[model samples]
Target: MGSLDELIRDLRRFDRRKEVTNALARKVREPVPPVRKKIRKRAIEVLPSSGGFGRWVSKLSITAAVKLQGRAAGIKLKGRRKGFPDKQPKVDLRRIDQGRAAAPSWGRRGEGDWHFQTVTPGFFTETTAEADEWRKAAVSAVDEALGVIRRG
Candidate 1:
């Protein structure tokens, strides 16, 4: 019940509070962990489990701890789903999902002799679709943080 300027300052201060920042981060990250696990599981199922490429690819779902940046909370929704060994970024999940990955032609001794395998497709896409609800939840969380309660 203060002046408009004071109320605006207080709102800004509230937005910058540690608890609020954490809440915002939580909202952003809420969709990630479970989706990550599902993607990992799917990776195990669809991709070959050799050279630990599939395993490392599955490990790409990283949820960093909540961070406050310039009075705003942030988190990244990421997946590399990139490569192997967890250290070196090799392989590309998108290409693989699109059937672009190639396995070395057995008994051949050159990089020129690589063949794309015909495995089941759409593992990443289908599984990721299942987490759509969490996205809506995240949006609603942001709205709530702004004191905008959703009805319906």
Candidate 2:
């Protein structure tokens, strides 16, 4: 019931839709990262094992503080409760636990491909403030590494 011009326009619209759909399907079927190989090489160069500008920067260190409170104090003098001790015990100072940072490693491959495993150092602080300082240093290191990658 439509005019001839309107019918032609409808057909053209359908054809355009079909074309777009086919194009999208083909694109989806293609390999992703069109430049995967290049990216990989760049990533390697930007992230090296040691003695490189990106080496220290790419490492992430996260430090956590842990508070360890001493046990409860017992009652003073004897003849108290059955569970009570003769004297009140002194409480030990709370200690802080510090975390260490290391590089994240991808799995190793045959033929000279090496990986860097993450190594966490033992706690080194007795206070939360010291632990926080270590954590901030780690974050800064990671940020520096990201900056290097972006520049590349």
Taking all chains together, each candidate's TM-score versus the true structure is 0.55, 0.20
lDDT of all predictions? 0.58, 0.28
Candidate with best lDDT: 1
For candidate 1, the TM-score is 0.55
- Across 1-152, the per-residue lDDT of candidate 2 in tens digits comes to 22323322343435343443334333332332222233233323433346341233222132122211224221111111111142212211111011222222343333344333333222112222233333343334334333333343
Error of 2 at 138 (Å): 40
User: How many steric clashes between backbone atoms does each model show?
Assistant: 0, 0
Off by over 4 Å in 1: 1-23, 49-56, 62-76, 81-89, 107-114, 148-152
What pairs collide in candidate 1?
none
Model 1 lDDT per residue over 1-152, tens place: 12223323444656345555466667767677777788789877877777564665577655534443445444335455443253334666666666566666774636466677765566677776677855665556555555521121
**What clash pairs does model 2 have?**
none
